[model samples]
Target chain A: MSNKVTYTEIVEALSRKTGFSKSKSEEFIKGVIGLAKQDLDENGKAVITNFGSFTVKEVAERQGQNPQTGEPITIPAHKRVNFSAYKPLRERVNAPFAHLETELLEEESGTDEQESEVTPPPKEAEAKKEPVSPSSRKKDNDNSGLMIAALLLLVIVALASGWFLMTADEETPATDQAAIETPQTPEATETMDDVAMEENSEETNTEQVGQADSPQATEPQSDSLPENPETTEQRATGSVDTPETYQVESGEWYWVIAEKVYGESGFWPLLFQANETLEDDPDQLYPSMGLEVPELEGTVATPTSNDYQRLALASTMVSEAYQRAGKTEKAEEYARFAEKWERQSRQ
Target chain B: MTKADVIKQLAEELDLTQEETDQLYDSFVEGMITLLSNNRGFTLPGLGSFHAEVRTEHKSYNPHYQQMMKIPPKKVVHFKQSSVLRDELNEGEDEQ
Candidate 1:
């Protein structure tokens, strides 16, 4: 219950313990406390072995009220003493808990140390890093890989479809009539370009062989010119207020369809929302299915004449891939669709 | 422990005169006071290091005086136990 632990009393105890005169014992105690004070004054802290650590922190100025006068005042910043017991001493203070499992005691001590560190809030800020989403990291590989594979496969299929369509055209003379009535779709436009190129080659070969043959084979070609204006009229009419129907060709995914129609791949949702076949899986577009290519409201943009040709070429190749894969139903349907459009654009 | 008891024990243990020990104790205390007043800290090996520190100026209210006060920046003295001493203190508790 005795509270006072004065410097004089400490000196007396020191003197008695060392069997020294009162003055000598007092002087020893004085020297130690004195050095400690000087250290505190200059360095703001002092350390004593087997005891604890002392630190001095600067307390910032703040507002405070006088208890008696009820008057507000500014409390200026000042030095504050802090004590942290060494690991050994601290463990001793917590000796009662030390009997518990050593790991548990250590864990509790570590948390205490961490909590003490948290007194300065800035340390917490350094602990947190900018969170890059795990999902974003995971998707990087899949996206790039899928894009490259799809493009390579599409190119190979397109070339094959072009060759197939040319051979088919040589056999079917009735295709000339259907070409006049059908509206030029993207697939049709591409088929026509291929057909025209193949015909030029064929014409040269025919000339080489027809040294003895007659020129009557050129008559059907002359008949095909007047039918051109009729198809142009239909393009103009097709560009009017109504939405035109498109026959889905092989290898036509909603993403590509949206890009061809809307000028952006992101518009795939529009195609997915508009079509029934795409309802179950927007990526599962089969060849030869009729799709209502709805006109965008308030905007009257249509795929360019060139776009139709490009799409036709691309889809024709996609169908060829289906043929090679043994899905002949898909290949034939898309071939029929492309042939229909090619004739339509022959005008 | 009391000063008399300490002196008695040291006298017995060292076979030295109490008067001689008291002289040695006095000189050590004087040396410490001189160094500390000048804002220096003393270190004892196997004990710990001692040093002084400074704080910036600040203001505060003195409740006892019932008035606001501007407290100038000042140094404070502190002590830390040496690791050796701390280990000694922690002894039996650390035994597995």
Candidate 2:
């Protein structure tokens, strides 16, 4: 027996259990989520003991590179929140509702059986009270025969019309071929020749326009090029460029700065690693926090080959443990993890 | 087993018709998808919870070939099973 549970069942069950309207239940759920986020943000941690814990951590500032240009850039400090499941909570979250589904299915089948039994009684009762005449039965049979004949005639007419339309379409293609083979008038030819000449002149005009516009485009290109060169030189001389320095402007959050630098809000941890001098609190960043931008190491940061091997080993271990415990779903999960890590290592 | 097969079994067990089973299954899946897509988690008593987790895009480095490749950010679906289910499955293993 399988218990297949769905969202509707969840919502309906919750509503019924709580004696609340569906909409009210949904609103209550949303409210709980909002409260959870608020609790995490305000208290640094939100713990629902049977469920999980959400914790906000501060990530320090760091130096990263623009992936597109491979040029080194400073990734500023940031804050991020993460969730971790308690053991019992994790188990509950992954549990299948197969038993519940089986129960629901059995209840429905029982009702259906009852309904089927009930349906025959009414039919039997109706049959006991009603009788048909022979003349009326013969008249009904004749009417049905006439209706069948009409339906056949209609089908035949439809087929004939379809055949005619198909033949008409086939005949038109020959005329179309004949039209294509026919020669155009000299006047028409002359017009086409004039159009081609006009197109050639248009192309020449476009080239002239492009040449005239080159100087305007070059002016901005030259200005932008010099700015970069000066900045590059300043960077090479180990001097901080004022324009590139991320000044802690008013109304700035550390997380926001971290997001700008790392191109993701979650990379604040790397930022924290780069700036060890700053306080560890992500929300406590102050103005004029001097951040050191690290030079590019010129190597792509990735999990090592050993990490993949370890992940594979861990997954296999987890699966074996799960199988030994008779946890089919958990075993399957570990199998999926092994496959995923294996593919990642291969890539 | 296929989702439909599971739903069918649920229907049989719950005394529901095939049509009702299908409706329940669809609503459940659609609801979960909607919640997860919105980066929310849903909980069902005696079942498990479904949630979305963010994954960082890591650059792939090959030491042998000396190549670096950029990975992209992704959101993944995560599920956790309930204690009742886990305990039921693991009960026999403790004796062994």
Candidate 3:
């Protein structure tokens, strides 16, 4: 027998078991459901011995927000129908797993001591790796911090130098390459330089962020890093999968691409940063142009405040870029987008 | 409706004796229980479908007792209402 036994089949089975006509059995089944419905409607509850009970529950009205606009709204109250099976019927349904037993754990008095003892070995291992007096340890910390800052500074210098060289060429190809590299490098360094006086201070702030992120990040990276390339290959070839890049179609603009990718027209700046070939002229997108869609850790389906902050920063950069290019109207448009995202982030 | 109330109503509607109606109701409940216990689902055309689903076991911390309790996995019956029945029940709900 297949899993789903239909109504007629059940009636047929009922007739065979009860020595009643099929029509009579069907009528009985219909009558029971009708009565239960009436009972629930009138009394808000119905009880059937050895079967289950049905209840009509009133759900109170609650405050909510319109997801698109972030405007506060009221969710109207509603009625919900609920069913709970009787104990005998519940036990019958659970027959397959009846042998399983719940286990209550006894709390151990030494749990705190055990955790403290467990934590020391890892610290001891780290200490063994860098055995030093207090002064030497401080020196080592400074040296490591300097090393990171120096590396980041070198990367920024190299990218800036490359952009300058590309500008000197006065050709589209070099500019295209530079444009792709320019958006990320300049934006990152701009924020760092604006906020901090020294590279060493920037390094310390970055280290704090890294430390905060590492506990969750390290466990996934240990195994997933090896599989990343294969997954990217799959994504590139699989047309049915979630698209990682969008090919610009005829009549499409930055707002359309932004809408398609991030579900908001205001997020065009994020799209610009992903491609950056559109940096010089954001409106000159041609057909068959492939634009990368940067994979965000969390999608806008349920955006966090942190996501809004990042989007606001991107929008602000686009506004600043347009202002520098002497396009006041376009700059103002992006500035409005930045303001909207900033307000959302604050909320 | 209580089982006795249902039996009485069925007896009146179908022109059957109380004893016969009671027997028929028991037989129906027995059949449903047997089908569900065997991990098979049944659909009543205008009413609904009854299916058994297995819920996985998991450990939950009991903050009051300061200990973890492991809940064992088990199968449970779920009833989904037919659209026709749902609409009938929710009729004029939106107008309210």
Candidate 4:
């Protein structure tokens, strides 16, 4: 190990082996060196056959301190080069003595020269000699056995602790219930009693009243209705005087008018249903087209004036066009317009 | 093999004179050197590729003072044997 050989020596030996002249060998070596430099500078990599590659790497700029002055300095970013030895080079350099060991082993085992000499001793001999030293050997065996027993005892203790923890958790709910019952405030207790007394009084009063009023309540209901019959007829006749009317006006898209009146444009379909003479496609209506806003059955009457009628007619025409094209969403829009006109007329 | 032994063998095999064999050997060496000088690598058909490598500027440690140091990279030459040569040389050994 003390006698370190240089690369030159190896190259000289190679030249001798290959019958290359001294000058030629030097030139060849120089050529290889120059090429490697050029490759790194140009492409950032130099790939040598069977000898691995050299790569150029960039180092980022970083903060560094001057060792001498301990002053902070910015180390400017730079490129660096590195070499990685290939598999063959690594094998040759790392374990040169491997072959020697193989040779020695082969000689000892009486194997062919081609076979590697490095071999460990037979296992049987090593095993048989183990029990010879009784005191130390026995101590070693006892220590191992003690270790195993200690481990087993630890596992048992852990299991027992886990069981205790689980049972303790299960008892917590019962302990909580006992804690809850032990706390009682006088005011809270009084409030609960008051609520119970009030409920009892209300129930008793309701039962007494039900018994006293039942027959009389039934008799008054029939007598009161006839007295309001004339007034009900007058109210019904009053609605006919202010019948709802709708009128169409100029410059309005049916969809726009429908959307403004109804929250959704989809209510237009109901407008077509209200006016049987109008086409199902509501978009065909021109300006000034008239329509009757239909009353929503069983609801308060919505009055539609003449002007409102025309607007409702236009909205229905647009809605019907959308409906005929299988656009149910647009058809529902005009329906809302008629409803809006009816509401306004009633107002 | 020795140079003399190689020459004598070549003479015997090719029926050439010793002087002619020597000339042939010299030309081969010169040719290989020239090829490598121009291309930076030489590929012998059954041997392997021989190439030159360079180590560029890199940051390294100067252990003496426990400080970072810049080691200006240097160029070097290396030889690599081909697979064919490796197999032939290690013919009898078990690969594993």
Fnat values, candidates in order: 0.01, 0.00, 0.59, 0.00
What TM-score is obtained by chain A of candidate 1? 0.26
lDDT of the candidates, in the order given: 0.42, 0.42, 0.63, 0.41
* lDDT digits (tens) for residues B1-96 of candidate 2: 334555455556555566755554444444444334333466554334657554443555534323343333334556564454334333444311
Please estimate how well model 4 matches the true structure, expressed as its whole-model Cα lDDT.
0.41
The residue-by-residue lDDT of candidate 2 on A1-347, one tens digit each, is: 01233555556644533455666445434433444544554576654433456665655677888999999987655445455765543322222110111001122223353334344344443343233223333554578766644543443344344434543444432212112322221222222222223345333433233122223323333333223323332343344211123334345654465455433333333333333221223344443332333322221245555545455655665565456557778678767877776777677
Model 1 chain A poorest 10 in a row by lDDT: A96-105
Q: How far is candidate 1 from the true structure (C-alpha RMSD, Å)?
A: 43.5
Q: Candidate 4: misplaced stretches above 4 Å?
A: A1-11, A96-347, B1-96
DockQ of every candidate structure? 0.01, 0.02, 0.23, 0.01
Residue-level error in angstroms, candidate 4, position A278: 99
lDDT of 4 by residue, A9-117 (tens): 4345335434666554444444444455546556766654444576766567789999999999887665555556565444333221111110011112223321221
How do all models score by TM-score?
0.24, 0.24, 0.43, 0.23
What are the per-residue Cα lDDT tens digits for candidate 1 across A1-347? 11223345445434533456777555444444444444555676765333445566656778989989989987666555556645543432222122221011122223354334333542333232112122322443467866544543443345345534653554533212222322212233233223233335333333222111112233322332233223333442455443344434457776665555555654344444334220122345554333446555433245544434444544564455456557788677666755654554353
**For model 3, how does the per-residue alpha-carbon lDDT over B20-42 read when each residue is reduced to its tens digit?**
88888988888787667545688
Clashing pairs in 3: none
Better of 1 and 3 by DockQ: 3
Estimate candidate 3's RMSD in Å.
Answer: 26.0
Worst 10 residues of 4 chain B by lDDT: B31-40
Candidate 3 TM-score versus the reference = 0.43
